[model samples]
Target: MLPVSSELTRSTPVVEYVIGKRQYRSLLEVTSTSTIRGVKKKIEDKIDKPMRYKFYVKILLTWSFRQLTWTGLQENRSLDDYGVRNGDTVRAILTRTSVTRELALDESSPWRKDVSEISDRDTGDWPRRLLHIPTMKSLTWRPGNRYGGKEGPEYEAPEYAALSYTWGKYRDETAEPISIGETEWPVPRIEPTHFTVHDFRRVINRIRRYSGTDFLWLDVACVNQGPDSDEGRLEVGRQAAIFRRAEKTYIWFTTLSEKDWPKSADPDYLQQNIGLFEKILNDPWFGSVWTLQEAYIPAYSYVLDRAGSKLPEISGCGDGTSFKTFTRTCTWLNHYSDTPRVSAARDVVPLLRKSGILAIDSGNPFILYGAAARRRATNKNDRIYGIQQIFGFQLGNTAPNKQTQQYDVNELEIQFTQELLKNYPVGSQMHVFAGSPNFGRGWHANEFSELPDKLPARFIDIFEEILRLDIRRSQNQDQQNRRGLSHLQCLCKFEPRQTESYILGHFSGQMCAFPDLLEAVPESSKVELLVALDYHKDSEVLADLESSVKYLEENTRRYISLYTHDRRRVVSNPGGFAFGKRLKNRHKCRLAVLKLGVHTRSRERSHDVSTFIGLMLMQESGYWRRLGFCLWRVWHPVEDYDKIQWTEEEGYFT
Candidate 1:
């Protein structure tokens, strides 16, 4: 024991170790290139106990007098990879590992590692787990600065593709076993489960083979749907950002079970029977509200069958870009079929290509809510959550309720509208747009839903018009950029009267309420009688309605070109023009006005010459609900300012 051999000293270096906060330390002789796992094996041999499942290794550092800190190390990496030297102390921190195989993604999976230091957690750069398709391993991926800053060359994030598909009804309500790495873990039977074990195996194998995507983020397997659902809710909040940052988003259509299609089709098959292709393309996948954001966010999105084969017809449209494919498909489908689903698919094309660019790059939500109007979701809140990302904002608190496992759609709408207000400048006329006739929410209003049929399939036509007219009008980019941000120029705020019964606003000329409103009109009701604005068979409305339509047309023409192409639809289509048309007897229906605020025709010209823009509303259960947007001039001058009581405060619409 007096002298150790020179060879032993050269080959094995003594490394110090501190277990947890205990002062006890152990010295182990190991090579400089020994892996963290290899050292852990030596420690287990010395103690005759296994620590892989119970402890994580960390390099303990002492900088100044009694100043101590530690950096966690990956078990598979070597000490040399982290630049750990001999005599450096490493700590073994005790931690709990996932004990059951039933948990879809086990925290103790060998392929998983924590890589939080370099990740941008603030922007949701990290997903909880990623399924490594090549290895068939579900790896835990925590990306944030939450862990102490530990710089290393070995620990770096990998690029991944994300799956966007509707969670269809389960084939059978039974637990299916999935092989995660070498372990066969049982997938839990949750409501709205996506795939059976057989289906999952067949689909993922195809995805890997066809798309050439090695890493995938499939929600059904990646997200935890069991008891620890808090983590699942957190994952849901980060989903939009995850999709935005993903290398590619695969739009998964039907599995095309052998029973249905028998064999995969080529571009010729789709070209030969374009109707079946249209039917295939218009699967429930395209009808999903969630898929809208999924389809539009990524830089490159490929439409794929569950078999993992890219839709030959769509991928063949252009150089594999969705914008090009959607444009060509919309043109082709116009001649092929005019089914409701086909029309809905056509409506989504422009939305994905707003500002004549990809909607994700342009950050334009001009038609976001409108695009979502027709898409279906089992949950009501998804209508807002689905499209909010296109607007460059994500609702942090939109997770499903804990007890009910659903959302309070009413409360969620308020938060959504408020967030939308932050994105636009003050005095935005977007608030005045008509919401979905089916939905009662104020934020649901927009021109897209009002006249969906009127929209031009090609948004580039409108974008070109704006650029061409910009030279003539000499409009600046700033003005053009902020087009939809403000329409009611000199808008003043107004408050609703607190009384149970109060006059809404005065109407001009002899008028009669609609037959439906006559039933709701009561002596004690707040809206005693909704004075009808004369319905003109040719124009939007006889008098008051013309101003709103003109402003909508003019502003859109100046900034974007959608309205110019379909001005007639705005004027004459019974269900397309005004709130009155939403009711029965479209020709006889009259627009009823509820005054929002007064705005000068031109503040530069004269503040005295002002026109008040009112909301086109309908009475329901003694309260008024907005049906569409309406504008009209005030017949009487505002001599008594106190009686009108207009302030610059915020005006909320219902």
Candidate 2:
């Protein structure tokens, strides 16, 4: 490939720039003519401390790069707004991990392999947009077991890579033939390994020190810029690959050590150390499970927010793209069903994979054989110890120097592990699994109290199967680029509920659909006449949804039907989140869309055009066909509801 872009090491001394967290220092000088995003990456390496994504991380330009200076940059915007020259100390900083940790780094490890540097020709007018320095020459790059772009006892470090695209090529989505360097250009050897790149400015000082490159690989840095457009152009799959390649990947959990951080610009950066783990999941290998540090777990949910009624929004990892992350580097690598459940069953996609760190999938899919994916890998090593460690992360209980919010995280991990040991490890692989809370005192409400005795044996067997499956692919999982496992099914489950009339779902237990559709509203409103309940305006409407559900439980007897459907969307991750049919053609959604108490039945089925469903009845009186129109009628506590249903229908119907 003819080079559309190139970098050169200046014969003159290289000037260092101190911007935000990153300090920019490179052998090759850059100009404002390059790119705002590219310039940000170069600056990322010099940071002395680890910082989270600035959200909109900025570069305070200073020093004179031939022409560009801090004052000039503040006055104008855009890389092309001005030009940069060699020997210019362009101070720039990105809150993201811009430094590499070289201090006290275990240099004596047997597996250490240093990054090899690029030759003179490798840098000048290089046609290849993807620059890879398989080994860093300047630093005597050696793979190490501790961390950074090095190897461990069980694995060798993958080469460092960085991609440079001249926005011109990528700006066009429908461009002619695909160019890997253009669309998804893979940077040759930059940090010499993905681990060093992520932990660069964060754990240590310079990107070059960790490997040998001034450039940083950041998803936010490559985007067109701005939240809306950046989201559209960002390729999470590629980003996932980059994280997977790293020895340690940083995850952003919504909850921060302090409430001010989110609005403060930098998001939380939880480290995930999956070094040897890289070999376990070879799908576009990132780094080793051990080399991968932090073991960060970002929580992504498909939860809904309640305004007054229900605000349909998926909670945690809101969309599954983040969930589909490479096994070794993902958010909430493991979580229980009740920690916080998704509003939709399909939202399970991101949470279940090896990288997803999930214990369940679509709430209902677990019942089907589809949830058996957990059986593909057996964890011979005792994760129980690790699970206990997570429990140690109790909130407020955290030590003086520790973050307080960590407790919530540990609870989530423990819950997930407990569910897995009880259900997934049985001889039978769980194709679907659901999680809920283990509460105060009532043994009957305890999830396990009701479990059949055989359930434990079944769980053990399933766990064995998962180990065997992982063992078969262990070679790939442990290979240089840990190839991740796929073709695995995800599971999701919910506690059963009693069905109520005028509302969709069974009437015996917790409304199966309630977990997803449940919403609450303000208690103090003139509309209180409608619900006959007073709820606070700010309290989550779910609190009210729960109340209304209880109201229905105590007074109503009728039950409407429920069913499942498929759909897809990508909010943060990738196509990592998708819809799947757990129960095909089963009657569901017969809902209490409108509450006209006392089984207000309407004979006339309204539609833009009717009869679409009429002909099937002629064929046979199947159980489904025997059922009437699908409409949920609820029995409201208000007795007056019975008085208004027979109002004179349209003249013809009357």
Candidate 3:
């Protein structure tokens, strides 16, 4: 017979245990040497329950509120062996018992009801308190089944894991229905047929098998896609919230193969597999505008390969790894990839920065949009709608309370830019226009050209003039020359300058002499320079010289300040100089200006010349911080400043 002690003993240690919402403090005769089973018995007696149900005692090991790692107390070990202290709080979590049941999808199934009905609130006159998202079918796992069966009353928001994937080209019209116990439920119909039921089944099965969760919130099955349906529109608007509420999000990269994964234990093998890993990351899923929020919003997100194996969490990739690490690796990998989609991948940086997932100093939406312009979205309006969440706007509207307003694709694009300019500082907005490649060219030209009168015109005029020159020059050039000219145009667009008087005055006052400036100027301009110097005493020419000098100094300082504050450091490859560079010498700040390309006397080659100036400030630690960059064509020598002219007839700076 087992010994039973019903009375409270003074020598017993007091322990606090939590079961669901209830907390219990129990005094027992169990010692530090007492096994976990002994403690469980005490808990059962305190709660007045039989020990027939299986439950585990879990202790919180980490402080992460969103994703606390809970370690289970070993039943065979003593309380002290598992690190249970006198007053430590332990949570009892009951595990579901194994049961075999038929999975049936009928009208009574929770998924069949409208989302609005699921909520308990009945706001009769209130303008639909919450969005009515369509109910999506989810599969639950059953114990003792090889192919786990679906078990669901329908998942409440925050109860299921969400899936993010690229549909690719496999848009089958119809396939076999998924088996739910003995009955088969018809797959949710999707128009334009982007995926089949078989595809859905594979994803559902994999998620259930690996995650040990039966219910999954998949966009393809859950979101109604009818063009005119209110359900579809509402779902689109609530997308951010849906993803944010998910317990965990699973990102499925179709291109990732099981064979390519290197053994984690093998260092040499992992090194060789880095290239393949990078290539796998470059898959189209990373470039999709819609997946950006799906990847970042969830508290716990996992990347799954084709075979359902979880890829290493982005944080687990290590400092030696170089897949463009962000503050949170999972967020970075979800929103970015490599190579073919580098531009689109970079666009997410500013959004991440804005969302607080990245450092606050990173650039804003206006600067990022240019890089994202190349990303593909089947619906052109999605280009604008996809990033609304990042800007703190609800889907289809700038704010949640505002009435949903549908606009044409072009109008939506214009409104997005206008909204950005309205919210952020005008100076930063201008700087983005100056830095982005797509802002003042091709389709984006008209948007920037029609800026509201409140915005300063100095920067806009500069971009317009540069763009006009590029367009005129390209009309006469071959395909190769046009491509080179296009690149030059982008460089011209990014040339940083300050139009604000207070900041401009401070920058203009700083003086630095360049002895080699004359040598860098074209020789043919020597005579023109002599002619200009002869008239230096003239007030107009003298004023022009001083004004030009002030402009140059201010522009140089502006670029440097922007570079120092705006650029991301080279964390992975410290030696590379692409984004920013650290100096080997630590004593003082170094300023270097180089004339890029050959200075030519020919009128045609003048357009090809550009100046490259950089400023590097060295910290006491001996590392250099890159401060700024200035790349632009100097039409003529500063000595002949008055002679340098812009002519409509010539269509080029002369």
Which candidate achieves the best lDDT against the true structure?
Answer: 1
Whole-model Cα lDDT of every candidate shown, in order: 0.43, 0.23, 0.37
Candidate 3 lDDT by residue in tens digits, 197-230: 5555666677666655555666544554345556
Residue-wise lDDT of candidate 2 within 1-654, one digit each (tens)?
021124433322233342222112233355545555555455444333434544232221111001112322432254435433322234342333333332232443222333243321222211111212222211111223111222322211222323211121113333332111222233222222222233322322232233344333433233323323322122221232332233222232211122211111011221112222232233221111211111221112111111111112213333232222322122232322113332221233332343323222221111211122222222211122112212121112222223222344334333433333233221112221122222211101111111111122213332222333322222122111112211111121212122231111111111112121212111111111111111122323323332333333233322211110110111111121111121111224221111111111123343111110000000112111101111121223221232222121110000
Q: Which stretches of candidate 3 lie over 4 Å from their true place?
A: 1-158, 168-170, 174-199, 262-274, 313-372, 395-405, 422-654
For candidate 1, write residues 75-180 as lDDT tens digits: 7888767654433345454323332222233344322434433222322445667777766666665432121112322223455677887763333455655656
Positional deviation of residue 333's Cα in model 1 after best superposition, in angstroms:
4.1
TM-score: which is higher, 2 or 3? 3
Task: Write down the RMSD of all candidates, one decimal each.
Answer: 18.8, 25.6, 20.7
Candidate 2 has what TM-score? 0.21
